[model samples]
Structure formats: C-alpha cells, structure tokens
Target: MSVYARRRRRSGTLMELVLTFVALGLLALLTLSGIARQSAGEPILPWIQPSSGNHLPHGVNYQIDALDPTTLAPMATLPQKGMVELRLAVTNDSALPVTFSFPTSMQCEFVARKVHTYVGGLFVLPLEVWRSSYFHNVSRHASRLTLNPAQTKVYVANWTLDPFDTGEASAGTYQVSASFGKSTIPLHIDKPL
Candidate 1:
C-alpha cells in the first residue's frame, strides 16, 4: 500500500441541502404573499379613487389627485383645509422601462397659492403661497429610480393646513400644484375636498 492514504471525496451534507431548500421556499412564500395582497385589492394605498387628469406625455405621464385625510379615500372636490393628502402618481407608458434621477429622496414638490380673482373670472392673481412643501428629504444625495413598462408609482404627501397660519389659504380657492421632474400640474384647491 502507498504511504499516503486516499481520502474519500466530500459531498454536501444533508443539513446544507435542507437549509438551502428552506431558504428558497421562504423567499417564494414572501414574494407570493406580497403579490396576493396587491391582487386581492387590499387597502394598500392611502387613496382609493381613480385619477382625474393625466399628463399625456409620450414616454411617461403624471397624475395628481386629492385624498380625504381621515378615510384615505379619493376626494373629488377641492382639498379642504386642515390635514390634507395629495396623491402623486407617475406612470411609465413607454414600451421600455423609464428611469428618473432625483436630487433627493423627495421625489416631488408641492405648493398651493391663494388665487385672487378680481372682477369675477377676469383678472387672476396668485397671492401668498401656503402648504408650500418644497423639501421633504433634505439630503444632498442623489437617487435613481426605474419604472418598468406599465408601472405606476404613487407617493402620498401630507401637510397640515391652517388658514390661521397664512390668511391666504383660508376656506377659499387656491392653485395647488406639484412638480415632478420637469413637469408641473396645477389644480384648483377649493373647499370640502
């Protein structure tokens, strides 16, 4: 016999195979759970209404809508004062995925300016701005986002409105606008919204 003994070839242990299988199975279960939640129409959103208007861009479109603060439902009327929520939706309508580079985590900026209409619907002047939420994530870091074709991303922004703070936005008409990337959409902000 040779001085050196021939060692038996090692194979994966039973525990190793079982662990790997269990990990994969767990991952699948979690992924399916998320899919089921979305497909089952669970209350997974802050708003529960269809969009009103859409920006008909070629590649990507945007839609802005108001939502009731308490029930988190879609508000058809102008957003009311007090706690308000706006739904910002960005959709990828192109065949390929669309990517956006944001300077910060705050993907959008919102501002509502008091609309001063003189002599009925004749002269319109925008007064002091209210609910001006310019920055949410103040970080200087940049972030990149990619949306697959037919994918829509919705962001909910909350701001407390008090006519007391600025006499401009009190129980009246205002122009509420949101800016996403290079596009901006404005809607009338009235009462009982």
Candidate 2:
C-alpha cells in the first residue's frame, strides 16, 4: 500500500474508536440519570426476614404483637409521632419455668403495607443515630423476667418518633419485631397523621 493511503486509513480507524467511546459515555450518563429520576430514594433493607413456621427453639411460644398504649387496643399501624408498644406474649409449653431475656434495644422499621410489608431501613437511620450515638445508652441497666410454665406474661418495648424531628418521617406501613432466643415477629406500624 502507498504510505499516504496507509496513514489515512490508520487515522480514520482511530477517529472511529474515539467516537465509539464518546457515544458509550454519553449513553451511560443518560442511563444513570434516568435511573436516578425514577427512584424516590434507595430501597431500605435493614432486617433480614425469616422463612418458616416457628423460629423459637425453647419449646416456649413467643407471640410478638403491637399495642397502642394510649387506646389499649391491638394495632396494625403505629402513629408516626405517638408511641407504639411491642408486646411479647410468652407461653411456656415446657414443664418448667424459663427466664426471658429481652434484647438491649428492639428495632422498628418503616415499611410499605401490601401483600408483604417491605421494610424501609434507611428511613429510621437518623433516629437510630440520635438514640445510640448521641444518647449512648446512658442510664440503661440489665433486667430479666421469668415466666412459669403454662403461664403467659406480656412484655413491652415502646417506640415513638420525636415530635421535634423535622426529618422525613413519612407516614406509611412499618413493623417492629423482637427476637427472644431464636424467635422474632414483625409488628405493623403506620405513618403519623
């Protein structure tokens, strides 16, 4: 091939390669912005759910339910600014007394109410950070409760959003469940009025 012809061919190939990369880069930017515009925010996945009939292993049944402490009624959704208490009704099927140990702190999540409650983990991150990081569990102490066989006692863990918190504590479906030994349940929570 002639020298000039070979040089021209090589430059054309190089230009095509650069144009291809520029097109791909523009395409990527457009795709990412479209995704960002579609989502309200990131989906929260805080607590891992279980798949089985019973997770409690101690022959003790722990039914985790929620109560509106003010109304003293069973609740499906907790008020955003009010208190919703998690009640653990413990029944020992065994023939002996079992001591129940509640975790230091129970977790609550905002979720979507539907066929399945999708947990919103990040929604409550600010509250958690305020509780643990700022407060640091000050003045908290250890306590345990014992239950007799065939007896069912209800234990409570209450949660509420601070009225002054101006953050996005949106009203929607939420759940609060605690694990005792190897069992846990999800409590339903609703957004504030």
Candidate 3:
C-alpha cells in the first residue's frame, strides 16, 4: 500500500476508537444517575425483605415465646382489672449472634366496654393497679438485649386494666405485635372473663 493511504487508515481507526470510548463513558454516567434517582429515599435490596418471617438479613433465626401471665397458666382465667404479668423469650436459633431492637407498643385493646368496666370497678385499689404498673415501668428498660449464638433472653411486658379507666376489654381477641427495624411478629391475646 502507498504510505499516504496507510497513514490515513491508521488515523481513521484511532478516531473511531475514541468515539467508542466516549459513548461508553456517557452510558455509564446515565446508568449511575438513574440508580441514584431510584434510591432517593431508601436503598432497596431485591433479595432482602425486612418484614419476612423471623429470618434476619444475615441468616439469623429468632424465636418469640407465647405470653404467659405470671400468676395463671397459659389458658387460665383471671380478673379483668388485675395485673397480667407476661414474659417474652427470644432465642437465637442460628450459629451466629444477632443484635436487634424491640417494639415498645405490642398490646392492643379490642373490647372497649370490658376495658372500661374493669378500669372503673376493679382497678380502683392502688395496690391492685400497681401490679399492672410494674410491667410497664420496667419494660421500658428491659429491651435492647443482645444474644450470642444459641443464647436466649426474656423480656417482660405487663398489661394492666384499671377499674375506673375503662371497661373490662371484651372476651373476644387482641394482638401483641413485636417489631425490630422493618421486621414484626404479631401474637394473639385472648381476654379472660
């Protein structure tokens, strides 16, 4: 080939290479900006669902014990206006320890009439009302427990129905929800007549 022709071909090839690189750089910039816009609020992982059943992000398993009143059996009955002592046990069922936060509000009232009745009639006595107060006062500081691999800890959640505050909650049903970050578990509560 002639020298002039060879030189022209080499220059054209270099220009084409530069243009290709510029196009690729622009594409990369656009891709990054699009990601930033989509994640403006919070980062979402396609494989991670914080609200999934007791499974932690790193494969940690957790157990929540059924609430048992200290003075009565799990299925036993008690006065509507008395204190109900309960404990929540968390067990780490994995090989590694996991750290998590607990929810403050778990108990919900269903029967407004029963709650009012109990509050007005039975919870009048300070001592009887104090029994239920113990759990609420102490539970505030009992959360934030850490567990090692195969470790377990108990958390106390007390529920009291005052005699004059409201009626005894109905005998139907209620729920106590436990939460950590975006994860939560709801436990059913049966009110005794």
In what order do the candidates fall by TM-score, top score first?
1, 2, 3
The prediction achieving the highest lDDT against the true structure is 1
TM-score of 3: 0.42
Give every collision pair in model 2: 77-190, 78-189, 78-190, 80-192, 171-191, 174-189
Task: Please give the CA lDDT of all the candidate structures.
Answer: 0.63, 0.52, 0.46
In angstroms, the error of model 3 at 141 is 14
Best by TM-score: 1
The C-alpha stretches of model 3 lying farther than 4 A from their native spots are 1-69, 76-79, 101-145
Displacement of residue 40 (Cα, Å) in model 1 is: 42
lDDT of 2: 0.52
Where does model 2 exceed 4 Å of error?
Answer: 1-54, 99-146, 165-167
Per-residue accuracy of model 1 over 67-169 as CA lDDT, tens digit each: 7779987766554356778778888989998788877766677777666544333334566465445543366788778899999998777766664665434
The sequence of per-residue lDDT tens digits that candidate 3 reaches over residues 84-120 is 5555455677787777754544221111111221222
Clashing pairs in 1: 78-193
Model 2: lowest-lDDT 10 consecutive positions: 124-133
